[model samples]
Target: MHASAHVDTFARDHLPPPGQWPGLHFDLPELRYPARLNAAAELLGGGVPERPVFRTPAGPPWTYGELRARVDRLAHVLTGELGVVPGNRVLLRGPTTPWLAACWLAVLKAGAIAVTVLAQQRPRELRTMCAIARVGHALCDVRSVGDLAGAGIPGLRIAVYGGDAPDDLLNRRADAGPFPAVDTAADDVALIAFTSGTTGRPKGCLHFHQDVLAIADTFSRHVLAPRADDVFAGSPPLGFTFGLGGLLVFPMRAGASALLLEQAGPRQLLAAIAAHRVSVLFNAPTAYRAMLGGLDGHDVSSLRRCVSAGENLPEATWRAWHERTGLRLINGIGATELLHVFLSAADERIRPGTTGVPVPGWRARVQDGNGDPVPDGRPGLLAVRGPVGCRYLADPRQREYVRDGWNVTGDTYVRETDGYFRYVARADDMIVSAGYNIAGPEVEDALLRHPDVVEAAVVGRPDEARGRVVVAFAVLRPGARPDAEALRAFLTAELAPYKCPREILFLDALPRTATGKLQRFLLRARGDTGVDTDGDQQ
Candidate 1:
């Protein structure tokens, strides 16, 4: 391995051991990039002059030329005023706003690695991220400034944005002449995106300058196929990699514009789509299901593509959306480690229930525990390798993520003879009962088919006779109340008796992370306690 030519080698030095890294293969010509590359320049500089790039509800749209000028001024402020040298880590904390996007680009433009943190994060999570990334400077939203300051990270210099502070990002040096984009190696660390840490501590997933463009080139260009006049909108916060690529990189790569929404719930997202005539949407399956309830009032005719990731999309959700809107829902499975979508189906090739085949530049297969490929039609662990893979920031878990040069995504899937991948469940979400292995998601999907069930989650609980029995937690639609016996009968008719939940617990709402991911671990904890609050025990 060659030494990095970066000014600050903190990120490079802290990377996991070389032997733990998954083998990277960039066989595609489009995947190959120059040794020296700047992601900010590659993403934003190629936009058509005077074309709209970003738009919001409150303010006028920002054209490419105007955005470039702001990026240059911020780059100057980062390097000149904040003393951000090459490879230094700069933390960005904010909701999905135009200024936050600009700040992310400015960090890369100034040759610093951008560390994105979610706005909903508390002081403890903030301190952990700052400590892990060794963040030197921060550009935070005004509302989060007090919390960040209270975190008390050592030697962290903070600059507030969207406020009256003198050093606010909006009031920064606007007259600074165009600052040249930093010339950094293609493999240089450009962004350190922290994982959602649902299991434990958040780990930083390091992405290179070229890796940023590879996602847009592969998934966005080949799958979503955005047009120059298209408008992209979604609910994901910019802190998540799914949001970063869908809202910023993909749109910019195609010379399209993005609608930035600070708070995008089901109603807000639908309203924005109609108001802006958005053509592309990126959100979770849960959101798509929520959006279906009020589709009669909103005109979403302009929506040409709908991409769902961050979780497996149930067949019921996919069919419901398509039935309502007459638009095929694109289903994909991506990981923070891999940067963006590696497995997906788009356009006419999409299969409603499946996650589809690997993207053009990637290879995916179902593998046994021994890292050997499993026969088609057999459920096994999902492994993928491509131009992009996991590169953890000095964590021992890297060894678990990369095995035999393939990135082992902790998912179970079945590879059909037709070459499509059908998701079974997360590797840990499999339930073993009475010598029969069952995927909890399968039962959950069956429950979702019931009209009264708004959401469902299934897990296995210890049972003396069966070893483990299937248990379900459900949220019902307003004014709809189905008791445990009725739901049990429904599941028994839809699935095998062994797969039917022995107990059904109804809750007002299911616990979810900020990104709309179901917190199954919390549900599992509830199951372990054998407590039924709704008194639906059978």
Candidate 2:
């Protein structure tokens, strides 16, 4: 496939003209702004102090009017007392709390970009991010003990928000002089979120101020479609875009209540949903799979919409979930480079094995080695373009990610004529065994279909003769563990011999990012990669 092929694949006949379906397509109306503050100000109508914006089971909910006061006070503290200068990088570390939301808005209101990090990140990772972003200030909650202490976080100044607001801190008077919103250009870097690549080191993805709202417009407007009366909940760390957008931004943007929890495991998520009447669930497929047991026992009638991402939605996982809950999962693909999901589909349009069409406002095409678009149902590298285009900040990785004005993500995909894109595998995860180029995810998807398997990941181990051999790691469902021979025979019966894993390694769990993606690089990083020394495969 060549670039010309991409042009042909998405020609006028294949898609409506650009911006053809106004409300259904291009979502510039909700997010068309230079800074993100406009989203709140516009929602509030600037008359009645913005309505209440936050809700939680642990404490009283805060309204939009009250939320604004926090952002204003924090912004004043950032500039007047804390000295967070324009364009400064202020690293924010905290759980999913109102304080966290305020910190995010405050940093932007004060003319600084908030650099968020996973509270679970080790010391070395924090140092790397601080150095790359040139962090000037840090706002963290001291409550998190142990490894999340920010031991290696280097900042010119540090402010602790949770313990208490200091008396000396700048708190705005009701009539304090015009604390006008900071002037921000559409191109200004609003955030620098890091996503771990196939290579372990996390890559910082730059997002503009305008992007803050584009995600809600695209995610909430087209995908989630949450009404003002809807209640929201998700299982992503606040630092992760998947979590931040779904739990915080998306609901608030629509004047809905977003349930926040310090922890959101399978049990916690289901409980929260039932308790708060949470109407939407935004989490990974793995979380959904894990909750199947509780779904059978819990009252989840409140959950109507579920969004699965961060990893491919296994066919079996989807079937089992839908079979148990009687609700189809809305599967989508999102990356840090694109800010939010550029390709997604509503549940009604979801195809079992494929990630549905390129989102309304976005254009996606699969290209071959020559960067030409591949025909429908054919596999190729995936590229996408939309209103929220790729613009990295001082990084050479951009050259490889963006070519011909289309952002070439690291994944492989296929398009079908009915308007859906299928996942092949990550370009880095594709293994070449003998003469065949095999996709690890495709094999893993097959393995997951087996009733005994709970989670699975496939990678290639180097071989002197075959060039590479397929290696799979699987986690079994709670009780029934089949013996090695039976499992091997089971796999052989299910898939083609060439696509089957040469060896299987069973484990309690697979290595995953905070967002719930299988980290294949870690599996390949193990010494004697094919050995499976744990001997848990059986």
Evaluated with lDDT, which candidate comes out highest? 1
lDDT of 1 by residue, 1-538 (tens): 3345479999888877877788887877888888888899987877897899999988899998888888889888888777889999999998888889999999998889999888988899999989988998999999878889999899999988899868787787655688788888888899999988476998899998988999998999888888999999999988999999999999999999999999899899999999999999999998999899989889999999999999989999999999999999999999999999999998889988899999989999999999999999999999999988899998888989999889999999999999999999999989999999989989989999999987899998888988889989998889986588998898889998889988899888888887778889888888888656463332
lDDT (Cα, tens digit) per residue for candidate 2, span 1-538: 0111111121112222232211212445654454324333333332234455667778777777777776776777777767666667778887777778778877776657788877777777777877766676777765542343446454446666566455322332333333466655554566778875545456677665666777877767887788877878888877888877887778777777777777889999888887888888888888988898787667898888888987788878888888988888999888877777878888678788888887766778899867788898888899888766555544556667777667788788888887688888887778888999898877887888777887888888998999989888888887866455667788888788988887777777888765576777778765243445354322
lDDT, each prediction: 0.89, 0.72
Q: What's the TM-score of each model vs. the native? A: 0.98, 0.88
lDDT of 2: 0.72
Report residue 533 deviation for candidate 1 (angstroms). Answer: 4.9
Clashes of each: 0, 12
Residue 358 miss distance in model 1 (angstroms): 0.5
